[model samples]
Target: MESVKAQSYDVHIDELAQAALNQHIAKNDYSKTFVLVDTNTKKYCLPAFEKKFEEPIDSIFEIEPGEENKNIQTCLQVWEQLSNFDGDRKSLLINLGGGVLTDLGGFVASTFKRGIDFINIPTTLLSMVDASIGGKTGVDLGSLKNQIGVINQPQMVLIFPEFLKTLDPRQIKSGYAEMLKHGLIKDKEYWDDLRRENIFEVASSIQKSIAIKNDVVMQDPTEKGLRKILNFGHTLGHAIESYCLENYDKKTLLHGEAIAIGMIMEGFLSHKLTGLSKLCLNEIKETFLQHFEKVDFDTNDMDAILKLLKYDKKNSHGNINFVLLQSIGVALTDIKVPENLFEEAFSYYKE
Candidate 1:
């Protein structure tokens, strides 16, 4: 099996597409195995997944796709199905899809009957890089993101870039944001290299993105120090995502798109607070503008977005702390910024 080593994790790359079933059957020799996929992923990638596993799969569970379906209700439904099938702690769950499937499936398997071994077959770039490595599994709670979850590592993370060929362009971009964030926080060379490449070409870019994430996760697996770098653009980015999902009628911004904007705004914040060079900040803004569609924010909308920031999971004692840049490759965490600055920073995108 082809594998890339991460700090505390071993990420099996595209090699798994050809070996997942046989490898598992020989290794675990479990009486039964379950494969989970959402409607879209089942239609798109399930055939190859089935072909790999010559042995009979205990069952296949298909859930409806979309962010709305990722929740407790869906988890309960999956649990009911497992119970009906006599699934036990010995059963293994192979989660095959994007971030939603991996995140939700990991959570279900971890909590089902106290816990069961689970493997991630990440078909989307986002899951391959971020979700698959972190051991963070959960579902959104109401307007909040990842409010209910656990930190249980998967037995193995199987990533197949071939599956990305079936992803929508927007889905591809959603994953690209995390890759970009990885560069922005810790690796300037990675940032420059990725900037020159076409993100849609998943095969070429997967290893680098995975390597960067692995290095970061290894430094702080429990999310204490270096791990905060991953949140560089997520502070305001998440607030924008939540606000757009809850109140807007226009095209809802995906996680990546929101972070693209967050990185720009945070670039501005970094410049103001740390004297991050104007040359670097402008380069960051222009790069995002080149790849992502500019999101227009009205004055009233900005107010709502700012209000949502206070609800961020990273807040401490009600203070709005953010991860801002010291330079392209350096990051500083927990910098408190006043509410008034949000209006000024947001105005940068109003054009």
Candidate 2:
């Protein structure tokens, strides 16, 4: 497979990914090389990475896995470790894990010494398709997702689809939701194709998802305009995700799981506010519900989630903005949704 070019780097897939990483390591002379993994990836992915790269890493840093751990405390720990190990501006950080690991690792490398080189070899399906492709890297601010971070590109994104084999069924299903969002916002045919596809046997769809996300990032790296479209379900999805992560009473929702609900709810908003047809709205909600188990939110859950909306990065002038579909393959960005519709959207999701 050919490498997909980003604004500053290339995203290499499958066969091309290994060569890209090996060549990149061979070519760079770094002060130190460190591999960052969460607990799960450290066990499942590190051996494969070592065998493939065949390079002696100066150090390996591991964090606990899950969305809750994506925070300042984790970043601080990694920073101290890096500082103790004498990581300088010339050091290279190889992030080899899922979204939480990659997200936190990228932020740590970007800020150490005012920025250092980092490579993302995303291990799980979610990271493979979305998290590792874009230059956007950050950790959560308490219950808020990505409230603290930077817009720094990786040296290159290396994706090995075989890494998906390390994941359980639930994780793969979680990643698939992001791919569906890609279809809902940009390519309806791709969405239609995904409905019939199997996650256990995968490769082409992973690359296609990468291409969709990379295309958006390349055009608007800073997210001044076009890039906001990538946040299709994220506006409400992130709030719902954060709510679940911190509340022990609620089951912790995976990033995609929360976004699945968000997509359905936002699809409701799109139909009511953006001229999306009723048929398409039902299609969007039903499509997501097929793969993801629906969470029944009580009134309290809705109240907390709505309060969380103000913290969304997309909001401007005290108004929450959304990326809503005009139709299956087209999207509008920076859309301000009325407060009155929030309950209706949630009610629509419940129905």
Candidate 3:
């Protein structure tokens, strides 16, 4: 098993139903074992988990799958289930799904009975590399992203590459965006490698990305400092995502798609504000556009997205702070971004 010890827990990467989970289960004394799954994971991933884990699952909780269902109401339902099943502080909750399931399950476990032990088994590539490793857990509060979440660690995380096979093409592509972001913020060579056609040849790249994130989290787990680099494409990306999800005319954008556009916009802003080279900006734009379709944001869409950015969790005292790239691997954090730049960013994205 390839293990990366992160901020508060260890992430074990190996084939599912192997030795790691069985050994870990033997070591813990939990009152009950609960596996939490979404509608999709229950149908797809649960069987694999059951075959791998020899221990009996005392209970299973299923929630609706998707960003729309990630709300307080779903959390309330989970809480009620845990309560009805007599879950206690010692009880274990194993979250088996993608980012949505892991986020909701971790939040529920952290808040239920003043926090219980939970394990994350992220089924999607996005969750495996980003969501499962970070220990950042929360459901979206309406259109705002991660506005209500606790920075609580999971008991352990299990990542099996086999899960990626079951994912839709778009889901696979969504997770790839995060891996691309990791390279953008930390290693230029890593980014270049990701762009290569034969990039999948390096199976180690997935674990390497997880390691990169783990290194960042170990330094700043609470987003108080260096951890902000992880939000390189997330600031405006999240605002755009929230805007599209809430708006009547626009279709809801996948997290990666929104962030891919965010990266392009931020790359332009980096050139205009942080002195990131024009060459680098164009390269960023081209690379993202190759993988993600350009989002058509008109004047009104831009206005709505900018308004939603005001409620971003990264903002402090009404000032919108952005994490911009100074170079491929160098980042500038907490830059006070003017609202006018947002209009220009929309123009750049449109072009």
Best by TM-score: 2
- In candidate 1, stretches whose alpha carbon ends up further than 4 angstroms from where it belongs are none
Candidate 2 wrongly placed segments (more than 4 Å): none
RMSD of 3: 1.5
Two-way TM-score contest, 2 vs 3, winner:
2
Order the candidates by TM-score, highest first — what do you get? Answer: 2, 3, 1
- Candidate 1: tens digits of C-alpha lDDT, residues 1-351: 357775455677666545744676687867568899998888999998887667788899989876677888999988888888889878888899988889999999999999998888898878888887878899888777788999898888877788888988988988888888888888899899888888777567777777777787877888887778789889899899888888747467878889999999999999988667989999899888888988878878888888888888878799998899999988998788877788779887654
The TM-scores of all predictions, comma-separated, are 0.95, 0.97, 0.97
Candidate 2 lDDT over 195-293, as tens digits, reads 778766656788888899888888888889988898999999989988898898999988888899999999999999899999999988888888888
| Clash pairs (backbone) in predicted model 3 | 17-52
How well is each residue in 1-351 modelled by candidate 3, as lDDT tens digits?
Answer: 478888778888876326778887889988999999988999988898898998899999999998999999999999999999999889999999989889999999999989999989999888887897778899999888788889899988988888877887777778888888998899999899888844333345778889999999899877799999999989999999999988878988888888999999999889999989999999999988888887787878887888898899888899988999999988889988777888898899898
Model 1 residue 184 lDDT score:
85
- Cα lDDT over the full model 2: 0.89
* lDDT (0 to 1) per candidate: 0.83, 0.89, 0.87
TM-score of 1: 0.95
The local lDDT score (0 to 100) that residue 313 gets in candidate 1 is 83
Candidate 2, residue 162: lDDT:
77
